[model samples]
Target: MTNAPFVVMKAVAKRWNGQLGVEDISLDIDEGSFVALLGPSGCGKSTSLRLLAGLEIPDEGQILIDGRDVTTSAASDRNLSMVFQSYALFPHLSVAENVIFGLKVRRVPRAERAKKMKRALQITGLEGLEHRKPGELSGGQRQRVALARAIVAGQRLCLMDEPLSNLDAKLRNSVRKDIKKLQRDLGITVIYVTHDQTEAMSMADKVVLMKDGRIQQVGTPDDLYNRPANTFVAEFVGAPPMALIQSSVLGGFDASLTLGLRAEHVSIVSKGEGQLSCTVSEAEFLGSETLIGLSHEGTVGLSVLQPGLALLDEGTTVDIAFDAANLHKFNQEGDRMSEV
Candidate 1:
């Protein structure tokens, strides 16, 4: 609506020693949107961030910040702040010093810097811990310091590369919510990069799924999960991912396709048309839910999620059903296809 993101990348590409780092790609990230670059390691997601941050110059094409060419601009001139996965705080500095490090480097007035430092600490829930060193705080607390440092810099755009990777599962989940809330309250444009699909789905307003140096798809989380553009997305997203039947059993039919259904969508419904018979192979209890692995006619394997505990034995036969509307069809080349 309003001139989307004030950032743009046009025909961007990067290569190193004849190996592609990122292929020609263009994107428009509107202001105040939390856009996540989601992909596996070595998938060019990080490379895209470097280019945007001016940490790496593009091999070709240009970058525009609010319609101004900044392709050749120095990293310092980019007016952006970044938080790395490592929580790269100066080891000897206390939390307060770390948060104001950027301001000091830019020679911001002492009084202004102090005011912003207090604000950053309060915003990140680090006010009382400002004097503590990174070594003295928990991993979650350390990451919050890094976030405060980025915000204190007063950059309109913030780039984060796996900021929660250092925490354990419980801490990761807790910090993820905190970060999302912070982004909302600040209303700052953020480009977050991570390989964890859960993080992307939970936080991003727009998710950019990447693979092998190219963008696979860019859409809202619901768009990617319910309407993947290809098999790769279906297999990569969702917890436990979508259960895929490698080849359809409808003999002589278009067996050159794979069927995609999320674990929660594939259920043991009452017998119905298009139902695929499967035998239970294993069941796992995950406290809030149960994961049941199934195989159809002893060949096609799949997994499903059911609320509460599963009561079936390993060999019990069950009809695994899915709503055709929730199904995604992919061709052998991994491209998605719409049913006729």
Candidate 2:
């Protein structure tokens, strides 16, 4: 990482017709750092990436790369690379040709283009498949081809818009690891856009979460998970999602307050031996752990994670407890009140 910022977005805003695409978005990307723009569909994450790519011009604010203003510059003039979800490769071109297309367009000598092509293919594990066309490759392999295209450019910044959206679960995980390793090895800055929290949390050094064209919070994965800025972040950044309860139901808390607890933090104990009592409403076997859903007094519903096949049947009563130290408090406005 570098001390000076490599990319800066100052209050950038984009609108389509009468509607806003992204509003007042600002960010500073450190050199060699991987940042993720995360949010649901239509939440402006992709739009933000396009803005940085110069595919969409911002109606307000400015974008600077390496301290150079490129707000209104062409995408090619920005000296950045982009990998799309569609793996936009020339169907008729061989893998090697596709990877070296940028160098060819830039009129690099044949020897220089070949050197870059070879290096890109080797880095992406596509050395043996260099002769194959996009049609002959698997989904993961094609994605690698697209990555090779980006890496061959040797740019300081790379913008990825849901690059793994087309891969299956198993392939997605494998390629995710490969991409992270490649980024570290190359020491290039990346801004990836994704709706999947798992991908964002696992890969990014920093996450910029968005909602309705505006930023909700920006933080590390642990920071977003442990200390969400508001209820929206608390509910969006988790896997099974955090369970929110009315504070009044837990005793000695005001009715206007809410409590947030993670499934892993809630432990099941014998009846009368825990802080709260509930009846099991549903149980799911998730290979290494059991997800037990509990309904309390026909009002509050919560999920708890129990290790390795603790099969409690539906309708069975179990007490649940969590340390006060793990509790998160929120006021009526949905903003974080305190970390208990």
Candidate 3:
């Protein structure tokens, strides 16, 4: 391979009858790195993945794979593999047949195909189930079969379109680790599409958070969590999300500014002895800690974490304090400000 990046999308844009699919999308994927395209539904993550996969041609810009321009090439010529959200296996085919179908199509020798199938099955823990059809396998097993198929060809680049969406929570967790381990063990590059922040944060080397057909942020999980580029990113990247308070709610700040806060940075103080007074809206016990949601006149998603079973009553007034240094300041347009 050349010294260039493994995959590159330079200002790629896709539209359907002048309706935007994804616009001005540009990204660089390093060899063997896991990059996640993460966003809400209809936010262009899948569209971007499709553009990269050559399933949809871009109206503008170019796509390069390992220094070769493949913008107008057929999907079959991309030299890549894909794992879909729907485990696209033939119902009549046994596990071994399904995994080696591509090899068969390429007219690989019988011995070589069998060796590849055996290795893929071993990597995916499907050795004993080789004779079973898709109808007889569990959802997780079917997904593993799809993964095995994707990797059986030894493609260096793999695109996954929310491959774990069909599995239940526990199965999703198990298969998530399995996929990451598979990618790492084989030294393959992966571009994964997902709307789940947990999956992106846990599995990806980099996250591309998108919204409304645009990339909101591109950074590491910690960078997005700690130094979000703007309010949209600040709110979208976390579970409970960052709380936004009107700057006027606090002293010495412009009314047009918004201040962002995290639950970990907020502390409950004695009544009337803190920065702001809030009403307890609800308390959710999460076994080890209680997530205490609070409401103030000018705050959105205000909450604090209280240690272990500290259930507070609704409408109870509590004082909350936060350090100035821990606050994130934003302009009226919601872009992050360096400091107050």
Candidate 4:
């Protein structure tokens, strides 16, 4: 028989008073894999992480970690470490002190704590800055201190709640790579919560996208990008998102259906030479390319990517073309249709 999942949340749910927090959540995670709980604010991603970390007991269903049912276990009883978005470091404590505080509280011997602290500091690249207090360090350095603390605990599973959110864009990118590398080197399972799709798409082996206290989809980055489960996912997963057009606007398809396609699949052709004619709504220039937003009578998120800098004027008429095979069809309820 095959081995069981390293972690499982079986129909787990939570609520406050009469309102829903998270409902009917079920998932399986493999060992040493990075899984990201991703969604917008109030989408229950953090609540789900709290439930898995034993910070919030589930109102329904069971949670299993390493084959043990910990649905009702206390947070202390679960062998997992947590890093929060706020860093949660004591300003008065030096980096070394903060890193080993958990071990000290657990009554680990002084010598052993020192050994663990040393390795944690080395791994997180904070060896020279160990004597500095949290207030004395940069935002990124303080966050690393929190990571060092988690490392020193020697837990096989770690939960991080938007640990990079406080950092600036550049620092977020830097620490994002650091956290992914740290998780890989330690061979630990990580359950991270984030509102940013970029972090989830870049760092996670699997992504569980939630909305309104429920899961929308769970799959690899590629699966969520190329084969979204529904319209919400199709519109939310990409940078520019997939452009959707009513099937009535196109021929050879059911009028009740919606058609989805990406900007990369759309090309600009000479006037009157393409499938659909649209008006330019806006043009945005990135470093390497420009995106031209298009407006048609029955389409949303319609756009085409132009190489270099091609700034089409607003209200300029353009013709865009795409292969029929690239179209993704959806039903009235927004669910994807199977390939025909």
TM-score for each predicted model, relative to the true structure: 0.93, 0.96, 0.98, 0.99
- The collision pairs in model 2 are none
| Residue 321, model 1: Cα distance from true site in angstroms | 3.0
Highest lDDT scorer:
4
- Higher-TM-score candidate of 2 and 4: 4
In terms of lDDT, which candidate is stronger, 1 or 4?
4
Local lDDT at 62 for model 4 = 98
lDDT of 1: 0.87
Tens-place lDDT per residue, model 2, 1-340, is: 6476899999999988979899999998889999999999999999999999999899999999999999999999999999999999999999998999888989989998888888888889998998899999999999999999999899989999999999999999999998999899999999999999999999999999999999999999999999999888988988678788888788888889888888999998777899988888899999899999888752344789989998888999888889977878889998899653
Instruction: Rank the candidate models, highest lDDT first.
Output: 4, 3, 2, 1
For every candidate in turn, the CA RMSD to the true structure comes to 2.2, 1.7, 1.4, 0.8
Best candidate per TM-score, number? Answer: 4
C-alpha root-mean-square deviation, candidate 4: 0.8
Q: Report the alpha-carbon TM-score of model 3 versus the true structure.
A: 0.98
lDDT string for model 3 (94-212, tens) is 99999999999999999999998999999999999999999999999999999999988889999999999999999999999999999999999999999999999999999999999
lDDT of each: 0.87, 0.91, 0.94, 0.94
Winner by TM-score between candidate 2 and candidate 1: 2
